[model samples]
Target: GIFGARPYKTFYVENDQVTFATLDPNFKEAVKLSADWYKKGLIDKEVFTRGWGARDAVLPTNMGGMTLDWFGSTASYNSLSTGQIPGFEFYPMEPIQIKDGVKSVTVGRNTTPEIGWGISAASKNPEQAIKFMDWWFSEEGRRTWNFGIEGKHYTMVDGKPVFTDYVLKNPDGKGPLKVLQEVGAQVSGPGVQQDAEYEFQYSNDIAKQGFEMYMKDGNTKRPLPILKYSPKDIKELDKIMALVNQTTEEYMQKWILGVSDVDADWDTYMSRIQQNGIERAKEIVQQGYNHYNSVK
Candidate 1:
């Protein structure tokens, strides 16, 4: 139900001015431009039908002489330098303007803490479970989980934890970190908090870049209103959302793959969505938003 329009972060040659149509622009112009790019072989043909990995098949081995990528941040550049594409170069672009003269980048809010843990209600040892949870959050536990045994997995670097060469290289077929994760020895639960230093100590350049991107773009984007719903409301919303999303995915794919003409088929697709009560769904979302705002 949330349908806020945003600009795309484009990767182009240095000093090139981007000219792609915005999401809310006239459909004719947008379709025409998109089709033109496809016809000219400038845009990847698989973009409409397949994902980036598949599309990468068409890229020249040397990346078609492209030196820039629209990535989250410089940290991303560092992280992505793995052996997948040896000697690949990446340059980050500043946020740019799009339609309606709006300048912004898209981002998602930080996930809530309770995203990944749950205790079975039928557990016989609930007290033990609670005690274990408490112990897991203790400082000693955090250090053990994040840094591993001081000398084995990591070493102290001026009092900061640094991964050993073996861990960094992921030397074995399955690294020590992966083994720890499988055993649930880390903060694998929702709502669990860890020290920022500990988190950063284990993060690679890609993670740092992602954090920088989020901070930078989050400061400029129009804030999305948070919403909450009642149980009944949630059930109804989920049902309607599934239908709407299915419809959107179908039509978007059809349009991109040239299976359906955008000009002639778009109105029909929109009308079908209207019949599915997208407007009512939107109203329900708005009500939730209003309620959440009121509580805030």
Candidate 2:
């Protein structure tokens, strides 16, 4: 597709500005392109209801074509390459430029780390919980969660963790994702940061190459740092965004699908939500950034 379909939210928070992408010239161009693609049937007809899972299910059977996905997860295509999909191929593509030289990959949403775990205040097994918590932060536990059983899931080469062929090419003809899932221990819960190195392991050659190429120009936009929020602040933020977010999603769907005219409807959409809850929410987010910077 000529357009990048991301940055879909009508609102974007950058530094101190809370801006509208619906009114952006570059983003409008992308929307126009997406609409054109939809008209041509080049875009999936069922895009609004369908997703990667649906596509993945059929792609293994050679029904459709390519899709954009996370760089880290792109290496899991070996499972689908078991000669079932005929011409199904997988590769990671570097960030591409869209109309007006808009970079496909940039400091944008979906790059932030957010999920975490916490113990209950009134737990029956406090001691067991404490022991497990300690183990989660341990190097050995992290290793187990990340690499799985070292010898079985991966091996050491020149003191670097090398994922074995069992992962690279599964003996049971399993795919990379399946093999890695079986062997690796996940450190995603509570206290562990995902080992960034494992993102490249046991994946295909093209994935590594693509990652390197994409990194040539740093394109990821990080979200605001974690900040303390009072319950009142949380309530205020939620109230502001709820309607705005819903309106954005609905309008976005209509605009992209040509249900509503992007040119005619965009301004009205912006104005409708402009003074709504957006400004105060923007202030709160900016305050979070400001607080984080001050502490740092």
Candidate 3:
């Protein structure tokens, strides 16, 4: 959720057994509140009718009050600045934790690596690619990439590396960091070890706060480890998954728009899923989960 926006939180279930999850009370409350909002016309009528239209309209402007967006740190910073919405102040709220909750937040593994330099498998000069990769990971190359030409892009301040005034001021209008990237400065990616201090220096305060929040609230669940299945299984799973997602969207929209009575309609929706082979789908998912757990 956006920093300092609604008191948003996430709950995870072992599989898709949301009904059995300890978070049902909170979820029920949230759904009721949303329904109330719809009835009160506080939320847009087309919010559920049209996919993403409400979001597209609401997210870009300072509507109702100062817009609070649930977006990536980089995107949020860029929007506030580059999008020219001034007087925008960003403050990161402490990650909310449910007291006596059944589960704490799970932090996920398999984070996307920072950009890495990879040679094209079809490259003619495979040897050169190998050499470049080797050099890029070396200490000398890292220093050159991060610090830049000694006295130009950065200088040591209190024995710590700092961006030079020239870079900070963006005298050339290209921005020092942009210029460096354009010139193929750093080798970033999954395999690369970035200097944390260097990154901290360039990152905005809000971004830093967001990062901290992520560390605090992020999930610890690694991506489900599953292998490729038979083509028939793959096709069957895809069809069933698509149907489940479609059903979810339909019911969620209906519930949010006050078009469906939650107490009654929810049960009907669940029944429909059961009739549509939800148990079989759950079995497939469980198999995949089992495969992942076994591999890990």
Stretches > 4 Å off in candidate 1: 1-87, 111-161, 172-214, 217-226
Greater lDDT among 1 and 3 belongs to 3
The better-scoring model by TM-score among 1 and 3 is 1
Clashing pairs in 2: 79-175, 106-219, 107-220, 107-221, 108-221, 145-185
CA lDDT of 273 in candidate 3?
Answer: 60
Can you write out model 3's per-residue Cα lDDT over 78-168, one digit (the tens) per residue? 4344544676555545444544442333334344442456678899999988897787568766666776656777776787668776655
RMSD, one per candidate, in order: 8.3, 4.0, 8.1
Error of 3 at 19 (Å): 9.3
TM-scores vs. true structure, each candidate: 0.59, 0.76, 0.53
Best by TM-score: 2
> Where's the lowest-lDDT run of ten residues in candidate 3?
1-10
- Where does candidate 1 clash, by residue pair? 113-190, 113-191, 114-190, 114-191
Candidate 1 at residue 222, lDDT? Answer: 32
**Model 1: how far residue 105 lies from native, Å:** 1.4
| Model 3 regions more than 4 Å off | 1-29, 40-56, 64-86, 98-109, 112-203, 217-227
